[model samples]
Target: MYGFRFEDVIVDDDAAADDLQAHLADAHGGKARPLCMCTPAGVPMYVAKVGEHYVIKRMPNTGGTHAPDCASYEPPAELSGLGEVKGEAIQENIEDGVTTLRLDFSLSKTGARIAPAPSGEAADTVRTDGAKLTLRGTLHYLWEEAGLNRWYPAMAGTRSWYVVRKFLLQAAAGKVSKGEPLGRSLYVPESYSQDNAAGITQRRIAHMAALAASGKTRKLMIAIGEVKEIAESRYGFKIVAKHLPDFPFMLSEELHLRLQKRFENELALWDSIEDSHLTFISTFGVGPTGIASIETLAVMVVSVNWIPFEHAYDKLMLDALTVQKRRFVKGLRYNLAENKPLACAVLADVLPKPVALYVQPPGIEQEDEDALSKLIGESDIPSWIWRAGEAMPELPLPSHDSASPGSSLHRRVPPRLSAPMLLAQKEGPESAW
Candidate 1:
């Protein structure tokens, strides 16, 4: 029960921290707008000006021994060495490799500036004119019931909390759109009150989405409407240009529209005809396999936590989005003939099975067979990908488990492509997950 709030009303920068803490006491659930300052040293600096500064953290730049997030004079003498705090878990990559997350903080203590950009451009980036407090660290931290981020202990996991929620809600929207829900236990926890439990799962999200467009609920609070509410009480929250935490999740109708736009950008296909030429195109899907949720994975890998919701609404909206980019480098390697494109159907039957096995966003079906043929032959997707799909399944695969095995209740999709195919030739190198 820890979070911050923002005022549509403006206040002096000096009072920001105190204002944040006071608001935190009232809301005490999730975060609102927090200042994001990235230092040149790659250190991401976050500040909540309390009476002075309550939680000061300086994530380290290297691993091994770690420390508290920041320095202070009041207490814990050892805590002064911010990077000296020992984490709860620390497994070295002694063997094949045990990736232990830790904080590595250091002052680049060198010349830095925000460089100038070319003419006509808004401004220069990565410049040296302005100094920045740089910081970057593996965020494997010590957690106590009363620790700062105890509310979200999973911060050390596969997805950032914001990323998890963004994709979780998005996935929920999709499941509900298909007349399915991840089920009550799988969505927004029941602990949520009417005031905050907007739509935790797909069903709730869908219901809430409808209420938003309906003029009847226009008088209600946005979170109350965006989230689930008792007696239909409502509230107002800022609708940022993109995804932001604490703001309620939009319903599936809204979800799909938003997701589709993201996929285009994420899939790197917003300008259907134009951009396709720039990015390697392929049909990817979220498969019904693995225990980790696709919603969680997609959010971590794609949205990086804060979802650009406004962009979720319109395909026209364009910004150099910061999304986790995935490539079939294996796909590119296996996808011989850079001249030809891949098809969705062919990609569906084959291709990206390895990546699929790991994480799929939640909607690819066997029934879309025609889509396979169309994508391979002549369809909406580019021809280069259409051709790539032809050579997709470079190797034979094990049987797909769409049905439940005797003792197993989980259904799963199999690896459609092989390492050999994924290892095929390519013009340039592709990004690894």
Candidate 2:
């Protein structure tokens, strides 16, 4: 069991609630104290008031300090895109017991209507680099901050879209985007239910009214949610997101085809991972009738554990590792239009260095070997691969010095093959990463 630290004294669970309240009232002026709780290993934590009680939350960057079985325990940040934007795209500032995040992405974009790209083609949007978060990175970051990416045996069967939507809304509060609190410019539809259907509808309309009021020079806002289905419509294609079941957004046929083609790999990965979710982030405008329609969009698949995956092979490996309670970080393709490659995932908390896992496409030709080797060889850290058609090999044990701290665990880009390099018999480059 973990203990709470009130200033210099440690208190056990029995006295934690009473003691924490007293400490805050006397020392911190009724505000949440910063890192007042410490784990057995001396990792800092904070007390969050839920209702009339306090619950301990792990301090940033110290999630690994908790025992794996602890409720507050989380996998290392290196296992997700969270590590990349910690100080760059996402900044956290603590003041007066409140934690606010200053984000680098813009919640609203103002411009003329964007034309739809041709079917099965990607538009040349801005690159994922620079200081701001990319569309894909924003989804990953939100999932991480909402605690959806962390799991334990106790959470089984209790998670749902409603719970996810609530947590995301809470997490996004006080987040700064484009010089304003993100909650003002962002809209996450409440989960659909018989009891709250009318309330949910009213809330959506009131929030979207701002966009609808923008008129011809409409301002686009960002929306994040699970993709339920995409199908043909008289106007074009309809996208039905999970939470907003009553509200299906319209997409141009040209844009729909582009999404299907560009996210083919993500779709396959989602299919292979049981209970996995396909999340979509889009810049959209609200119609006069309060209908939200997407202009620019991107989709990604996350495993049951909430780590994003790029291919079916990745889903298989992630499931196998997760069952064993091993921690790993999934890779992200920031620049979707680029032909560059990245690893499938990297195992964390291991010794000499973290283990980078790469999956080679099946039925490989001789030329593919050089490319595969070159990609894996780029990493100086110890690495392994699961070649197609072969059984997965045993992972290499971390060397004695593996636990040493350094920046070596950061993500690295892998080598990518162009569309023409793929064999005619296999899935296309877009779907078969």
Candidate 3:
């Protein structure tokens, strides 16, 4: 609720083994090899940055095509590699008072060609990476492990949904374990998570699944208060572990089911509403409807399908994904200032180009009231409420018709530029209209 502290570790896309191991050693405190598995039995596995291409070795007729479908994957600019990755520890990447971790993940060389079925197999067997990839733009996920439910109570509502989804992903990946999971996060929003942008959010989820399916990024971020730093290196890394507590695991299947059901129900409720809603109040006789309510007939403005969507998801991407219920107001109604940065960001993320919005609230300042009232033809009226019975505007009337031609009451003399108009000449008077 205060603020989040993250110490980022940047991994270059083209980084090799020495580059990665050196950083890991600093983070892992010269562990030579840090533990990379759920149960730390040995030093961590070495994630050697191998060459870009992959070759399938046919161990004597044990294989067929090099690739039944696609060949080597060329990673996009986003996840070709990382700037730096720690050895499954938070303190290794600490900066200031907080800590952070990041990595450039790529589609690993795990896929191999699908060989022909043995001579006379019943069905045409298929062979491909069990995970199916989709063409979505961006995706954001809120996930956690079944074990960590003890630490993060807010996940009680949606634990079942994730557990089930996690189970299915693990089964497909042909691996499942406690403590470790396919997708998870240290900070999961308390309420439902949403992804307004279709492609990006989905792609992000897919990318994470790719890691989980291929057995990578298998690390967890420990809670700060729950754990303590035991040691630190000269290069500012801390050796840490959980400060043991008497309480142990008691996460129930019933609770998990309840949470999953509640999450799904909430998601169904959200599906009922669009991204926007509009409420307008008819004031004075200005609206299309002739009858105006004294309290101003409320006009509800809604952002429906008609509202243009952005190529990338809007702020809604961050908003929709939550683990628990929260008191979040919809739209920017609470924003008092005239300038709308939040609205601007949301619109820019959705709209192709920039859009502008202006809001006019009730009330007028004393200084500009006179000028404003003059423009509205109510110069004589004084006060805030300009009802129908107020006084009308004042206009000058003509004075004695042509009695004193020199003195024009209706038309004031202009400031001199050319020679002034002569009303009447001494000998022969000429009247100018």
What TM-score would each prediction reach against the true structure? Answer: 0.19, 0.70, 0.15
Kindly give the stretch of ten consecutive residues in candidate 1 with the minimal lDDT sum.
292-301
Error of 2 at 165 (Å): 1.6
lDDT by residue (38-92, candidate 1, tens digit) is 1112222122222332322222232111111111001111111122322321222
lDDT of each: 0.21, 0.56, 0.21
Model 1 spans > 4 angstroms off: 1-99, 102-194, 197-391, 394-397, 400-404, 407-433
**What's the CA error at residue 169 for candidate 2, in Å?**
2.0
Among these predictions, the greatest lDDT belongs to 2
lDDT tens digits, residue span 283-360, model 3: 111012211111111111122311111211322322321222211111121101112112211111111111111111
| Residue-pair clashes per candidate | 64, 4, 52
Candidate 1 to native Cα RMSD, angstroms: 23.8
Error of 1 at 43 (Å): 40
What TM-score does structure 1 among the candidates reach? Answer: 0.19
